[model samples]
Target: MIVNRRGWMGLGAALGLPVLGSHAAAAAAPRQGQMVHHVFFWLKEPGRAGDREKLIAGLKTLRAIPEIRELRVGVPAPTEQRSVVDSSYHVSELMVFDTVADQARYQDHPVHKRFVETCGDLWARVVVYDSIDV
Candidate 1:
């Protein structure tokens, strides 16, 4: 999902807060900077276009949440390495929240729950990696 200037400001206003100047601002206090969380999903089957659409739609809902710093979604790129082949997974999602607490809240959010309920069956495996910038 794309977040424009006005959109970000609107989100801030909705939360009764000030608008952030950069993506970094949404991640943490200026002194601490931003942290990023990367999430990967392996689908149960291949060629489920309908399910993919639903997933995207669900993600858009997540994007609307003010706590989320950034949200990126896409499929893995094809590669030539035979041993490193990944064929079952259909898509991946990376979401960055303002803080660790925000991430936790997101996990427990109703919208996130709805997304999982609606699209969880389509995935065979899921992995999440989180890191903070030093």
Candidate 2:
């Protein structure tokens, strides 16, 4: 349960899993000119696992879009509750694109459209924040 780095590497080797090197990790980090699209969903039926799972599954389908560089789907973390922290949303997603144009393409992509059509009723409120490196 308490595996050290070497032990984890050995376990990964035994499992035939590809170890992520520094390069692979760096590839996921945000780069200048890349667009970060962050979305928060407040479910109509908050605290319902089924709805949350359905929304998460729908969000995952967006990864099929070619313009998307990276996609991360998550729920709020159980971090210390502070005035600056907002964990009210039931589900959240962070998508990275090579450029703002790429993100626009993703908005029009069929997969994203389908996701919206199918899962639109699940959330009562949706908020989005988009940014780029300065």
Candidate 3:
């Protein structure tokens, strides 16, 4: 159950999913001391396109926060159906920060605060996974 970075990358490859380094944003990938903030949002009205777009729009607004080095917004991929694949979330975002301190500042940034106030109700649940390089 304790998979390291390489293990996860291998699993993704085996599953025919896009591996980390293959992304167009690979140049912006987190370095050894950087941090990644990954977040998933499950909408209250799961399949509502209107709500989804509104939330995504709000998420885009957070890019104005200075501490974010790179930000990518996405929806679940149309990968093969498998128990390990979690496609329940309506939207997801992956943000890379130069450091943990930068990421922390992003949390309190006014743009982020405004995003929550504007789109918080769209999601019934939100989950986040913050990781640093091993």
Which numbered prediction scores highest in TM-score against the true structure?
Answer: 2
TM-score of 1: 0.65
Order of candidate numbers by TM-score, starting with the best: 2, 3, 1
Per-candidate TM equals 0.65, 0.78, 0.77
Candidate 3 — which residues are off by over 4 angstroms?
Answer: 1-29
For model 1, residues 9-99, the per-residue Cα lDDT tens digits are 8988999996656765657543254557777777676576687677667667778667788899887677775766865556777877667
Q: After TM-score superposition, what is the CA distance of residue 106 in candidate 2 from its true location, in Å?
A: 0.4
Which one is best on lDDT? 2
Q: Model 3, 9-93: lDDT tens per residue?
A: 8999899998767675777555788898999999999777699999989999998999998999999999999999989888999
Better candidate by lDDT, 2 or 3: 2
lDDT over C-alpha atoms for residue 95 of model 2: 91
Q: Tell me the whole-model lDDT of each prediction, alpha carbons only.
A: 0.75, 0.92, 0.91
Kindly list the per-residue Cα lDDT of model 2 for residues 31-111, writing each as its tens digit.
888889999999999767699899999999998999988899999999999999999999999998889999999988899
Residue 93 displacement in candidate 1 (angstroms): 0.9
Candidate 3, lDDT over the whole model: 0.91
Give me the runs in candidate 2 sitting further than 4 Å from their true place.
1-29, 47-49
Clashes of 1: 0
